[model samples]
Target: MSDDLIPGDESSAADAADAVYRELLERLGEAQPQPRLGATKRALELLGNPESSFAIIQIAGTNGKTSTARMIESILRAHGLRTGLFTSPHLVRFTERIGIDGERISDEAVARNWDDIKPYLAMVDAELTAAGEPALTFFEALTVLGFACFGDAPVDVAVVEVGMGGAWDSTNAADAEVAVFTPIDLDHVQRLGKTIAEIARTKAGIIKPGAQVVSAAQHPDARQAIVDAAAAVDDPAVFEGEEFALVQDAVAVGGQLITVRGRAGTYPELYLPLYGDHQGRNATLAIAAVEAFLGGATQPIAEDVLAEGLTEVASPGRLQLIGTEPTVLVDAAHNPHGAASLVAALGSYFDVDEIAFVVGILQDKDAAGILTTLAPAASGFFFTQSESERAIPAEELSRLAASLDLPASTFADTLDEAAEDARRWAEEAPRRLVVITGSITLVGEAIEVADDREWKATA
Candidate 1:
């Protein structure tokens, strides 16, 4: 199963990569994640364990994992290291999930890696079927693909983000030198657990023996779970609000000016071109995670190099401005925690007095919690559903809004219609903004529309 790997012809690379991605989609979807790593581990083992080829910084959390991982990869790349980043639930294309040197993994690379790894992946799939188990899932196969691509790139370091709860997440197959956690909240409750403590313990599984741990501040139960996990491994841990912190953040023109006390150094008043105070905290964790990984939480990052990295990081679909004129924006805030952050950012960052919300929630998410969180800030709701099979219908959101007595809202079967209607409504009023939230899928589609229509250039 090892390489006699032939390179793919570049002429048909896009078609070939699309076919490979479709095959991955044919497997179980990411929403139905199998809580096991055996299949992925087997596939990687056949590929001669490419996950071990580079140093890893595995991230686990309810939110901010992608943003944090992106920041970490940017910082490491800025320091002149060849870096690989693996994130999940791509907004535009599958290629967005894997990054090499701060750029998307190319179509050519995807096709080439799939050609090399397909034989090994097929071998694992056959083994599982024979044993009366399912084949590798979408996430599981994608996990192997990310590692294979990174190994082929032969990167200096890889920043890996967990697709779900840490214990059995396919990415956890890689033993990280630094196991990092963002705030553990009640997301994917059915898959992870019902309570915060249970979820935190499962996420803390990334903390292997001899691995260093870094974390954001957590609730008491979550904090204890991480502390226990680290103690059990006898590894050192540095928690946010204790070891390092987002010392200060103020609204800046494009984003924010922030100060961070990293594990090793203090980076004062850096310009991060991203919205939200949550993002400032996410950067703080990224800085500390990098400090812990590169310098073992002892040696400070050069201030100029650190600033260079922070300024270059862009996390699309999270509090992003997709349009202007009528001032349309999108935030991938699927849960109450994220929705709350969006509300706070709106108050702190923009001058809008009222917001017309375009929201879509997947079937498994807590729609009520999200609606409740946004209700206080909403001028009205344009209830809509994403194209995802998991998305709840637009009427469902309308019904939820009624149940909460929030407002009289309108429903749109398609995102485009909802956005169009919302924009028109916003344009008629002063200090009114169109803000899309409640799911990544909706936000991604909104972004696609914004790009196609040239929303920034035209009204």
Candidate 2:
């Protein structure tokens, strides 16, 4: 517990570090939930305001946030700018949370930086105790560490993914030159408000005073909330499909090809290698954000650089195909809105009679809603729990899927076994698709198993 002690100084150092990080995360879950706009500022104030050391592109929404953040970072990097990207809920290693110069920060870097920041963390804890306040949660500490990493590396810009709702989320502490909103929907009713209006209001909190706001096309109510929130901050709002638009979208050779028209300019034949109609919208937001970041200081963006940038960007787990021949696609569609998008994209890309599905979900998610959207397109369900302690139990999830009168079965705790079962069942023909979805954790596990099995190679 002492700051001077290094968790991994000995043979058990790795385990000790894991234990420390786990404890931090638990404390973060237990800490007072700020769910408002200024908690980040308080945390940053305690940390010497490292968040202001660099410019930022702030992204918040119910979905596509990670993709949008990656797209913006890629575009910025292609323009010869050194960029730092911070995202969350890693698919594999925890180090995926921070990317510098388009690569995951090295494990050595994570450990060394964590060790260096432990003293600051201890100080923060002591101050909280003295003030009769809860200690910094794992997320708060990690947010501080990101600022430290970015400041230390001294990247020109940082693309920050909001941990949860925008306003009170810890990442909001950073000053953003451009605030981007991906679509908003009902999720995280506990921390964020339940209604669309409430969720929209909470997300709109990221729009800073004088920042340029670029948003994915939103529902009318959500759009209004953003408008009102921007007015309060006196920020200029660029509404997708209104202030800017993607005039054309189609499947290109490398990925999706689209054209965007901003308020003041137009970009043609932009190639983004990600799939899905939603990505087209996400790409437009990214383009608008890049334009906004440039501050009209440059003429229209260089098309050659933009094309290369978009083609090189990769967002794993969003309609990602992990195997072929009874193709296995892994999508992190944990909610109804995302599930709907996944279904639409599948419809666009593949034609199959029966879609076999492996699904595991968290308890906080709308299980019934997600199932409803996916069940119609599914032939059967292989139910299991993903990585969250909050995940719905396998049997219970099966029952929920069965209540919809869809053929469903529960699996043992191991994702590897569950995925094996799903693949075997779908192997009557190689083209019969197997889909593992619901939570990113489950998809990650499935991907790991599929990799070990060489499922794609054999398929």
lDDT of each: 0.90, 0.81
Model 2 lDDT tens row, 1-459: 334445546534444445546655666562245554344455567667777888999999999999999999999999999989999777875668889999987544555667667776777678777887767776777787787788778799999999988878889877788999999999988878879899999999888887988889898889999999999978888788887888999886646789989665788878788888888988888888888898642456788878877888999888888887557889999999999998887777677867878899988889999988997788788888876777888888877777777666656576777777888888886557888999888877777777887777651
lDDT of 1 by residue, 153-207 (tens): 9899999999999999989988999999999999888888999999999999999
Clashes of 1: 0
Write down the TM-score of every candidate. 0.97, 0.92
Candidate 1 local Cα displacement, residue 164, angstroms: 0.5
Q: Which stretches of candidate 1 lie over 4 Å from their true place?
A: 1-11
| Pairs with steric clashes in candidate 1 | none
Residue 216 in model 2: shift from native, Å? 1.0
Top model number, TM-score: 1
Of the candidates shown, which would achieve the greatest lDDT relative to the real structure?
A: 1
Error of 1 at 134 (Å): 0.3
